[model samples]
Target: MGLLAGCWSAAATAQALDAPNVVVIGPNLVTSGQPTAQALARLSQQGFEAVIYLAPSSVPDAVGTEPEVVAQQGLEFIHLPVPFGSPTEGHFESFAAALQRLKGRKVLVHCQVNMRASTMVFLYRVIFEKESPASAWESVTRVWSPEGPWKRLALSQMVKHGIKFDPF
Candidate 1:
């Protein structure tokens, strides 16, 4: 019975950690495709301190009440409104700044489907966190390869930050 109970608890913990398109990047960071209100509620329990949304709030299926839900959960919410087709350096700058401000706090970064979120996290990890470029790029590719504007934005941010790893 003890063994069975232990397995059940482990399974329950894993279920609780589940989020839309969830990618557990590390202890301090997670990236997801989209965030529902219910998912936001689970964040605090999962040890997240804040959320960084990389797309506009209206980008198809976004929970319109995210701010309220996040507030209710006592977690900080920051929407960066990155346009999927035209991501700019300004957006990355803002993301990096917000992330830096929240340093050491567990943060969840999400976009419509993890593409934008993954790339941004990859860049942040590689540049600011001194993560291995190859390893961090693995998480980004697990969602999707950044192409078009995403590719351009990723490369440009790398250059701006003086990181020379070409993950393309």
Candidate 2:
């Protein structure tokens, strides 16, 4: 019975490891595709009151136009210039601070592809929110970022912060 229980638990946890929705990290929060007017509208309809953007250095025309449009929609916007694989200490501090500030507020945080977005979210969930490692990982996978160096950077951030979860 004990062995069966352990196996079942492992399986259950593994199944939960599957990704969650691409949008909406939580019920009131969302992170959509590169800043499109339509995507911003969708997030607004979902009730996100604040938006945190981590976009590529070279923002596209459609994406370039989003911040002003989103702001005009009456949602608060905070933009971070986060190029992949180059997360600075200030970037992590600001990101973590933003996460903390937005706690319980209707917020949406996103990067162009959400690879950096998801990575930051995972670290926030684990370190600040005190979520279980499994739960944090679940959130990470749910909005798994595309293949990039940001993933490695995120793991390094965790190690630098002295979190118990091993990146390896």
Write one digit per residue (lDDT tens) for candidate 2, span 1-168.
Answer: 487775664454323322223544455455544654656665555466788887664855326666676788788888877867677657878888987787787777777666677777777777777777666676666656434466566667677767767534
What residue pairs are clashing in model 1? none
- Estimate, for each residue in 44-152, the C-alpha lDDT of model 1 and write its tens digit: 8877889898889877788898888887889999989988899888888899999999999988898888998999888889988889889899988878888998888
lDDT of prediction 2: 0.64
Candidates in order have lDDT scores of: 0.83, 0.64
lDDT for predicted candidate 1 compared with the true structure: 0.83
Residue 29's lDDT within candidate 2 is 51
Error of 1 at 118 (Å): 0.4
TM-score: model 1 vs. ground truth: 0.87
For model 2 the local lDDT of residue 160 reads 78
**Top candidate by lDDT:** 1
- Give candidate 1 misplaced runs (Cα > 4 Å): 1-14
Candidate 2 accuracy as TM-score: 0.74
Model 2: how far is 5 from its true place, Å?
30
